[model samples]
Target: MNSNIDLKELWAKQETGIPDTKDLVKRVASFKRAHLKQVIYANILLLLVAVFIVLVWYYFQPEYITTKSGIVLIILAILAYLFSYNQSIPLLLKSSYEMSSADYLQQLLSLKRKQQFLEGIMTNLYFILLSTGLFLYMIEYTMRMKLPLGIFCYGITAGWIAFNWFYIKPKTIRKQREKIDGLINKFHLLTEQLTEKK
Candidate 1:
């Protein structure tokens, strides 16, 4: 009876270091809202760009088959990316409040996995299609220009694409990964604490 009392006293005194449940839930909900906003903004921007491209194609009416093919490819790339990216919306829309901690953790893990696939394979595919489309699309316009002007145009475009692929993309992916990973780690710690309490 003395030892039991001592154990209970020690347990009561020890710092579990777990955050308040309400606070944790609030943080998770905040992240979800932020993520949803990001997705919405991205989708809107991409759709606007696609519409602009279609208008350009319709108005300009390029003579070259290559230019037409390039337009098609660019539009396809955007659509395919949007399709894949939007797949996460349903998962994101599910309320965290309705889920058990373990279930929520599993959802987060699944989200992380989906994000990895998007950032990895889907990203590569999008870039490849976009680059190829741009190159092809530029050919007819560049051919009509003087040699020096054509060279300059190609050079500028290539440099911009290279910068986006090499620098901007990696930085964006790193930031996104850090945000999601941080949330996953927090939930993991929470789950561990809950398990210990039992």
Candidate 2:
């Protein structure tokens, strides 16, 4: 008796289809090898820049560094940069498998999901850098108790960020929504593959 098996039927029950595990692992491995090198190098550069900023701030403004706030912010900046740098590129690199068949396509799509997550993480890291820079500049003026042009520049920068965030954040959210859709599509494929394998 030949009973036609449609694995996709099972996948339809779930929100995201589970693809064949064999293809999943191999696809992830292959992607990591091809994509991570440049991304890692870029992150390393960002880390170096963060380190340089810390050194410069410490060297030039030892007198102004009475409060621990500036120091804490600097440390936080360094940490955020390092985290994004380490987490994303390595995640990308981990996808170094062979995608010989379409089986791995599901896993590759999952990798894209992780990549989107990394994008959010990196976005936060960049925000930290921007906020810290503004805080430090403001503190410098506040410490001296002097009203100067530099203070005005900082205020303007803050206002600009606020304005852009107010307007631009929605656009960013929309883009993220698209990424989510892409992820879902890939997941569906994965599920289809899994059902077939079964």
TM-score of each: 0.69, 0.54
Most lDDT-accurate candidate: 1
Instruction: Please give the lDDT score for candidate 1.
Output: 0.81
lDDT of 2 by residue, 40-114 (tens): 676678678667767866776655553346555755666775676567556645775786445466666677677
Worst 10 residues of 2 by lDDT: 1-10
| Candidate 2, position 70, lDDT | 55
Point out where model 2 deviates above 4 Å.
Answer: 1-37, 64-68, 71-75, 92-115, 125-129, 142-151, 167-177, 193-198
Q: List lDDT for all candidates, in order.
A: 0.81, 0.65
- Per-prediction backbone clash count: 0, 13
Give the clashing pairs for model 1.
none
Looking at model 1, report the run of 10 residues with the lowest lDDT sum.
88-97
Please give, for residues 92-161, the per-residue lDDT of candidate 1 as tens digits: 5654757887777767767766666665666677777888889888999999999999999999999998
